[model samples]
Structures are given as structure tokens and as C-alpha cells.
Target: MTIQWFPGHMTKARRQIEDKLKLIDVVIELLDARIPLSSRNPMVDEILKGKPRLVLLNKNDLADPKATAEWVQYFADQGLPAFPIDAATGTNVKEILPRVKQLWAHKIEAMLRKGINPRAIRALIVGIPNVGKSTLINQLAGKKIAATGDKPGVTKGQQWIKVGTEMDLLDTPGILWPKFEDQMVGMRLAATGAIKEELLHLDEIALFVIKYMVQHYGAGIQERFGVQDLPDDMDNIQEMVKVMEAIGRKRGCIVSGGKVDLDKTSLIIIRDLRAGKMGRISLEKPF
Candidate 1:
């Protein structure tokens, strides 16, 4: 499976972000908690070099709490202040400012020493699409300043949003790399809705989700779909097919010919996973 999704607009977005980087004091990088590493745009480090950064593990509400913690610690070890946040619900939104300020303290001190009046910190909000950048920005601004759509590519250009009197934020379009060096990264992004659903093989992604759940979250699936026995091993296609058929039959995703509807069944499973119906799960956790 070769997965690569990079539209031309993302190129334009990256160029704009590079140009806008000099105007900001810090970069607040948002990442889907379920796929912190995979959802990260590879170009961020180069584009945001020398800028103090804050990483928000957005959608922590839907991710395994333990994994989220490990990821936070991992980022902290790398000199970043990373926190778990549910941006859609405004969880931990208030806590962002202090951490970012703390990161920018040295610059603030330098300004004070130079007899320069300190200016409000400006942070560029960035992340992969649908990873909650817009939602987080809206929460920070206390209004819907940035477009918050459930799908990717909602916010297209750059705009500065004032958050209170002391802070300014630049909301940029979420970006992914031109090509994924690892195919599994693309799969993870698709599974977490970071990439547009129409751009990938939803059925393959759904099967990957189902397989992962069966391995790490069987009981949760059993409760959500009322299937007491999901196949324990997904490596066997026949066994996996049986499990999908069972789910389709139970969920009433059947056609007039009395056959299981793969598309509807796939959507049902994927939706349940995204909506937290299958319990908190993390596809890739830091070791």
C-alpha cells in the first residue's frame, strides 16, 4: 500500500507559513493525540526553526490517556512544553498562554533589558488538517475567528486573530508533507481523519482500524458493536472477513441480495472509532 496525499494548495500554505514565521514569537503546533508523530507535517521543523514551539496533543479526549502522557513527556524531553488538550471542548485551552509565555521568557527579558517595551507574544498556530488547529484557535480567541470544519482544508490563508489584548495568533492552514516516507503514517493519518476521507482507501483504513482495535481494544469493540467475539488475529484475511460480516449483519449494513455491505460497514466502524464509541485508542505510541 503506497499512500501519498499532497495537494498543490499545501505547497502554497507552506511557503506562506515560512514567510509568516518571522512575524511570530512562537509556534503553537497542534497534533492529533491519536497520531502525534504521524499527523506532524515533516516541514514544520525546518519552517519553524529557531522559533519557540508549544505542542498541543489535541483530541486527547479520544486518545488513550497513557499514550498521551508518554507523548507529552517525549516532547518535554525535547525542550517543548506539550500538553493534552481537547480543543473542540476547550479543555486545557486556558493553560496554553502561560506555557508559551514561559517559553518566550528569555526574549521578554532581553526586550526589558534593552529598554524596549515588551510586546504581546504572537504565535503561529499550525498542524495537519482536521487535527484541531482551528478549534484550538477559536477557543483561544473566545470566538470563531478561524474556520472550524470537521474536514480538512477548511482554513485556507493566513490571518491574525487577537486573543485578548496581550496575545496575537496567526492561524495557518494545516499541512501534510508532499509524500509520506512511511505508508503506515498515511494510514494513521487517514484513520484519525487528518487526511480527507475521499483521498484514501477508506475500506483499507477501516480494516486497519478494526485490526488494531481487535488487538488492543477488543472489549471496547465488543461493547460498541455487541460482537462478543471479534477475530483475535487479523493477519488471516478469512477470519477478518468473518468478523466484518458479523459486524455488518449485527449493524444491519446489508443489501437486498442478503449480502453484507462493506462500504457501510466500513464507515460504521471507522465512525465509531473517531467518535470515541470504541473507547480511547492510540495508533502509535512513543516507546
Candidate 2:
């Protein structure tokens, strides 16, 4: 099934960002390390219109280091400096301001040449929902200036937050495009909790997670859930269901008649994946 989510507030946010571009010196694009490409909004490049941008892969703590490293290099190859950071734990966050300054160094130097002291860098930070935009902003500001939540759409409005005297951040609400052109993108977002759970079919997301892990991270899944004899065919729906059921039984997700509660089991699988209980898993890799 195709997944689409475009709230009315997000439309307003897009327009507001355009109106405020005149004041922005640099754009910060935050992406989930596990699904960096998928978490990126397609409209970003067109909207920002070649503005200076620093791509930050947030939530790296829960993502596979190998894949994250590859993604960093991938962005670097494209001339966009990208790095992995854990906004929640403040890992690699200290480098943000330095990098922002580096991106706007030319502008800063121009002011110095005219005998004028440069002002704080005006940065516009944008990202898809639940990609840790709020958490990163709070970390940078060294306080809770932005609302933080695990679910998407926690920050509904744009707010200017001062990051000391070095930078001023414009935090915009996380936005998704009107429609996901690729169905896989929707599944990955839903599986990673970037999309609201209420808008998802949990079973489908659970299966997608299982199939991905089985293909690229079978050992971790087998060790995490103590399930063996994983199906060889990635397209075998029935075999995958058996594996999910086995995981549910192991996790004690049983209901009336001793049948596995698929819904609860799905939630458990997705939760474990997000919480890193299944190890440093990444739903996608740099292609």
C-alpha cells in the first residue's frame, strides 16, 4: 500500500521557510542514519535552491557504523559535508557549529575584510519528522528551547533559537512530501517510527523489517530473538510469518487460545529495532 502524509501545518511551514530564506545563511538537513536517503525530503534541494547546507545523519548510535560511515562518504562525494551524530547523547554534536562556520566561512571572511565583525550564523534546520531535529536543537542550545518527542509532528511551528553567540537556528516542523513515490520509502519510514504509527499497518512494517534483517543482518536477528532456521527466500511471506510468530512466542506475546498477537508482536519487533535491541541495524545502505 502507498503511504502519504501531508498535514496542513506542513504546507504553511514550507511557505514560511521560503519567506525566511532571505535571512538564512546556511541550511542544516538532518537525516536518520539508518535510512538517510529515505528520511531526506525530496523537495529540500529545490526549496533551498543551492543554499549552503550541512547534512547531519542523526541517531547514529542506533545505526550500523559501517553503513553510517558509507553514507557519510557518499554525501562527501557529492560535495555535501555529511557526518553521523547522536543528538540524544550529544555525540559528535560539538562539531556542528564548527562545521556551520566552515560552510559560511567565505561570508564571515568578507565581513572581516570590510572591518566589520561578523554576526552569528543564521541557520535554517530542516528534516523529516522524528529525525531528532528538536533533540539536536535542544542539545545545541544547551537547554530545552524546542519541544522534543519520540513521535513525529511534535514541533508544529517554527522558532528561532540562539545557539550561544555563534549561531541562530531556525527550527522548522518536520515535513514529508505529499506522497511517497516509492512504496519502500514509506515502509522504511514506518518501520523506523518516523511516520506516525496510527497511520501504518504494523504487520507490513514488521515484515519489511524482518525481510531486511534476514537479508543483511540475519545473525543479529537470530541472536536477538533466538530464532533459527530462517527462511532463505526473502519473498516467502509464509516463512517470514512463521519467523515473526516464533519471535512473538519467544517474547511472550500470546493472547487468547495461545495464538500470537500479531499486532503486539509487530509493535515489539519495531520497538526492538528502534531501541537497538536487535543490535546496530540499518534498514538501508548507501547504494
Candidate 3:
């Protein structure tokens, strides 16, 4: 399925971010830990214009630890410091300010030499919709300063939040690019809830999730749903359908005539995957 979602507000958000970058000391680029690369907005590099950025792989609690490690190292190789954090639980969220301070240490030191106290670090937090950007900001500020929700496009405007006396965070609405050159990227984003569910075909997203889980997380899926026999062929559509039906039966998502409700089943599978009920799963790995 070809999936694309770029609302008019996103264009306005991009422009707003550009206008605020001059006053910002660093950019906090949040990403979904399960699908790091897919959740990353490609336009960020172009828009930030080489501003120093720290990558936080949010929702690491729901991602395979092994995959998260590989991703952290992958970004390290690219000269970006990437950390695994769960904003909801506030795990590793406190470290963000210190790290941002580290990035702007030189500027701070220069101010100190001139007998000037360095002001709070001005940081711009950005990411695609539902990637946990606002959640992280709220965690850092010790209160609910930014609007957050499970669905995409929740934060419409930008606001500056004081993260204690150490940093000032500019919380911007999540921005997605105009188009996705690779459809799989869109599929991954959809599976991870970064894209709005209304804009996607639930069956296609469900199948994509099933195929990936079957290939990379076979035992996890079986154990989660209590399915004994699973098809090994990822390319077999019928086998995948059977798997879905089995899960549907297990979850009691049945319709009239005893037929499985594939649409409801799709929602269940996606919800389970996102809620970490299927275990710590990473949809993609560093290659």
C-alpha cells in the first residue's frame, strides 16, 4: 500500500521551526525505538541546516534490547549520540538535559570566561507525529506542558517549556515529509503508530507486521497468542491469512457465520504490538 500524510499544518510547522532555530542551541530528534530509521524525518537534516542534534530512541521499553543497542551504535558511527529512552516511564529522560549541556559546553565555557552566566540551554524538540516528542518534553519539565495524545497531529503549535533551570525546550508539532520514496518506510511508521490509522489500510499494515514478526520474532508471536504452529514462509499470503485468523479466534474477534473479523483482528494485532503485549519487538535493524 502507498501511504502518504502531509497536512497543511506540517508545512507551517516546518516554517515555524526554521524561524526558531537561530535561538536554539540544540535539536532533540525523537524516534521510535522499534523502527528508528523509519521514524526519522528525512527533512530534518535539510531544515536544521547542520544544527547539532541528539537522537533519542523513545519507547525502548517496547523494543528489543539487542536491536536498540545496534541502533544506538549505528547512530554513534554517524557522529550522532543516540540513547534509548521511554518517555512515559521517564527512563533515561533525565539524562537528556546533561547531554544537551554537553553539546553546548563550549558556548557555556565562552560565556563563563567573560564573567557571564550561561542562560538555560535552548533546545528544539522535533519528530514525526506520535513518536513521543511531547511526552519527553512533559517528562523533562516535570509537568504536562505540551499537548500529547496517542494519535498523530496532537501538538498543533509550538511552545517554550522550562526544563528546570538547565534548559528551555521548544516543543513543536511533529512533522512528516511530503512523500515516502520507499513504501516499507511508510508501512513501518504505520505499524508503530507514528502515522494516523485513518490514513492506512489496516489489513496491509497488519500483514506487514505479521510478516516481520514471523520472520524476526517467531517465538514471541507464538507465545503471545498461544499459537502452536506458525508458517515459516513469509511470502505466502494464505499462510499469513491463516495466522491472522488464528489470532482472531484466539482473541475472540469473530463476526456473523463464525467467520473471523479480519478488520477487528487487524486492530487487535496492531494494538498488541504497540502496547508491547507481543513482547519487545523491533521491526527493523541496522543493516
Query: Which of 1 and 2 is ahead in lDDT?
Result: 2
Query: Could you tell me the lDDT of residue 210 within candidate 2?
Result: 93
Worst 10 residues of 2 by lDDT: 171-180
Question: How many pairs of residues collide in each model?
Answer: 0, 0, 0
Tens-place lDDT digits, model 3, residues 1-287: 22255466667767877888877889888888998888877787888889888999999999999999999999999999999999999999889988998899999999999999889898988877778766787788798663544349675555677888889887554454523458999888878887766688999999999989888988888898887788978899999999999999999999999999999999999999988999999998997
TM-score of 1: 0.88
lDDT of each: 0.80, 0.85, 0.84
Which has the greatest TM-score? 2
User: Model 3: which residue pairs collide?
Assistant: none
TM-score per candidate, chains pooled:
0.88, 0.89, 0.89
Models, CA RMSD each: 4.8, 4.7, 4.7
Ranking by lDDT: 2, 3, 1
CA deviation > 4 Å runs, candidate 3: 1-10, 146-159, 171-181
- Candidates 1 and 3 compared by lDDT, better number: 3
Clashes of 2: 0
Taking the tens digit of each residue's C-alpha lDDT, what string does model 2 give over 93-174?
Answer: 9899999999999998999999999999999777876888778888887887635444497755456778878998875533
* TM-score, cand. 3: 0.89
